[model samples]
Target: MEINIFEIAKSSPSGSAAVTFMSYTMMENLLKPDFFNTSNDTIKTMMSTVISATLPKTNYTKLTKPVNFTLKHIREFDHSGSLSCVYWNISEWIVDGCAVLETNSSYTVCSCVHLSTFALIMQTRGPQKSDPPLELLNLVCVIVGLVFFTLALLTFALCQWSPGVNNVARINICISLLLAHLLLLLTQKFLNLIRPQQVLCAVISGLLHFLFLSGFVWMFIEAVLLFICVKNLSQISSKKREVLSSGFLCVIGYVVALVVVCVSVGLVPEGYGSEHCWIKIDQGFIWSFLGPVCVILAVSSEYKHFHMGC
Candidate 1:
């Protein structure tokens, strides 16, 4: 058998020689065409030449088609054969085109284009199943928290019997804590129903942190006041002094909480949870909350011992 490889050069001067040889080999295997026929050789040679000429240098390009077929049967093709042919042509085109682009460039373009196209395709497609919608969960939590808070508030308000100064301070602190939790829960519920507005989320998160910290500080103050009252039972009897002390402590708490929360959010805006943003405890958990709690407990214990001794 004799082959005129020079004919491929005449037909496809720009073609990759290697590609032409590979295609010819493939065609030979499939057709087993008789090389004795000049016409058959010429046809095979031309087809191989054309394919080589079109072959790309780099094997990278974005695939524009969706992974799944989104088009309706009627819209896609009038006949089944036509649809099959179209899909085959599309596949070949993607394979050839992808060979030309740089790998990284192709990947980035493919990802971005696919994402954009997928969004459009999804619009035409139906709603997808998501884990029991967040709205439902948030709604349940908000309702429950609100109900609990309302009942708690009413109970606190309706109780007319005056409590001791320390007890009154503790009640106020509890009320603040409950209110903070309620606000945090309500904000979270709203966030679930709607896409978060960054500014609003930040403000609400900051407020939540402030309130929570303030509540903690108030609790600490109540502990301190109780300790002082027990230790100096005779000297700390003035109602005005007691009220002034509580007020002063509250002011200090607010200031301290504001400073801490501001620093935290400023440094890392989303460091904490979405529901109740605060300084992340894990990083410096001991100093943030545990240290203060320990100090308060120690003070209270010492005061109790001193009083017992007296």
Candidate 2:
């Protein structure tokens, strides 16, 4: 650390007064309750201890000339983390008079106009420790579900049921749900690579929203059809058929989801991606996806009383 006396020395020179340097490694616990603004990321000090350098005789708050400080990194450096030159300011740590000059994996050089207790802080986007078992479980479950979904879709396509039975809703349900689950698993597995690319993350999140919603819509349609079939089995064998046409059912299956996603995008353009590759929770943006899901579920649960006129 370089401490140069500029105008302060010219006005009231410290002369031969010695500058004292002290490391408060043991006293770090006392200063642990800090008010550093690090958003949501986990924070850690680069060095194991805090250092204090002060001019014993002549004390100054602001210096006329900028000084430089080199803080060595004690822990392993992370490429995805951010580093800052911060100092104790009363009850908190801030970088008001300090700026990062040069940085490397080993150490960082900080240029500041004034000095106090100084240290280097690092912030990383991920948690300190992750549960490997939970992650493995999720991966295994999603893969198995995807395999079953694919098999169901293939069966629907190849197997021919009785002409009296309609499989339009079931087919669409399998197709949309399979695609949605696959996309979700892929996005999560590659989240680290995709999150940095803002535009790509946003697009993927929007696609996921549409696919999942479409799946829900198809499921609700199929549930309503099942209810009708269970209640009116004798009329199901009509030659001309009693239900809506396949084309109309197909359109309704996806159109509702598309419309909701379009409106959500129009209302909050920046709410597509966030901490995860999904709708951000900020500004009630998550409600857009949740609202439709809740509506579909509520309606489906009460489908027994609803008349389909089929």
Candidate 3:
């Protein structure tokens, strides 16, 4: 019937002091050793459900272990001014529902909330079930895509014997696309776990948008390069057709993507995603990506048709 409360004082700068206390209460219906020793599964299950709801939900999330309740009555002031028991290691005291009252009574009633092993178990609920086939399919697809793209990039980079304008364009395209897909996959899988950090989420969103846009930009660059190479096939050795190089083409592709991403972010920084950490699809912000893509696709198609017609 006796509840023990432990009070600890915490001091802050600027002349401020606060006290945190932990209270442990015993329930005869739940904490009795004989009650848990029953061989009846139905009775134990019912008691667990009852105990889970017995704790006040307005303050505490889960119930602590039973040993936290034993306390001795003391009426004195020690040098440390702390009346805590060594058995009170079951939970760490929090300030959620802690208070101290001045009274002339033999014992004080205190309510406190703390995090413990039971709280973690309650928060986790139970083991989650997932479809094994679906999980395996998703894993296989990601692994295959990653491997193929990696090999494709290595091949494009290592093919030094037949290096040409087209090969250079393909290499840049592969690098950009590879980075974009890798970043997108990583962010999608991991960014959701750290939603509490706003700045980090924003940075992740910006990077994903930039990388994806860079991928698309490189694709567009490849298209243009293809068109130019085809158009100048007959004048392959002409100095006039040698204006663009691999490095110059890379600069154009990356710079264009960077400028678009930077301008979009600067104009409406909030346009970056909120929940999923991606570009916001609303408020014309997405047009920055779609507009350029549409223009490039149109130009490439037009040039292709014209070259074919000639």
When 2 and 3 are scored with TM-score, the better candidate is: 2
* Higher-scoring candidate on lDDT, 1 or 3: 3
Q: Which ranges of candidate 3 are over 4 A from the true structure?
A: 1-139, 161-165, 234-237, 240-242
How many backbone clashes does every candidate have?
A: 4, 0, 0
What is the lDDT for 171 in model 2? 82
Which segments of model 1 are wrong by more than 4 Å?
1-148, 157-168, 193-195, 228-232, 238-246, 269-310
Tens-place lDDT digits, model 1, residues 1-310: 0123244334444532222112223432332222212221121111111111122342322223322212122121111011110111311212211211111211111111111111000001122345566757866876777677667667656675545544445556667677777776666546554223545655765677677677776666766676666565555566546554656766776787787776776666544443223334545632443554466567767866787697
Q: Rank the candidates by TM-score, best first.
A: 2, 3, 1
Q: How many clashing residue pairs are found in candidate 1?
A: 4
Summing lDDT over every window of 10 consecutive residues in candidate 1, give the lowest-scoring window: 115-124
Q: Which residue pairs in candidate 3 collide? A: none
Model 3, residue 204: displacement in angstroms?
A: 1.7
The numbered model that scores best in TM-score is 2
> TM-scores for all candidates?
0.44, 0.60, 0.53
Query: lDDT by residue for model 2 over 1-310, one digit each (tens)?
Result: 7776545556554444445677776655666524566656576555436788776666544566787878777776654467778888888878798888988878889887765787777776654365799989999999999999989988887787776567888888888888888988998899889877878988989998998899899988888677766676555535224256788788899889999999999988888877567888867889999999999999876665555543
Cα miss at 114, model 2 (Å)?
Answer: 18
